[model samples]
Target: MKVNYDAQNDVLKISLSSTPVRNCDFDKPGVVLGYGSDGSLVDLEIREASRKIDNPRSVDLAMNGRSVHGVRLL
Candidate 1:
């Protein structure tokens, strides 16, 4: 999984899997959902992320009960 944020566009993208997206849907005005060929959710995109999230620049990850804070791509 990977998360990326585009500060200039105020967009945040979270990839849930390595599957290639075959189609995309507008979940809402500022949200989009990506689906793979099999129609399984593959990723998510949020526009105007800064206004939607408390701190758009930060990321917190959790897996199997373990959590990580202050994660960034670089």
Candidate 2:
């Protein structure tokens, strides 16, 4: 999985699969869901992250109940 934030575009993307995106649909006004050719979810994108998120510049993620720094994870 990979996460990327484009400050210039104010977009935040969270990619869960490496599969090529074959289609995309807006789940909501500024939220888009990407799908692979197999119809599985590939990634998610949030537009205007600053307006939709409290702190667009900050990201705290945890996987498997643990964090990368071995500290608290949200």
User: Model 1, 1-74: lDDT tens per residue?
Assistant: 88888998999999999999999998589999999999999999999998998887888888899999977644
Query: In model 1, what is the error at residue 31, expressed in angstroms?
Result: 0.4
Residue 32 miss distance in model 2 (angstroms): 0.8
* Candidate 2 structure quality by residue, lDDT tens digits, 1-74: 87777888999898998999999997589999999999999999999987887766666667899765422212
lDDT of each: 0.90, 0.83
- Where's the lowest-lDDT run of ten residues in candidate 2? 65-74
lDDT of 2 at 18: 92
Model 2 residue 4 CA deviation (Å) reads 0.9
Best by lDDT: 1
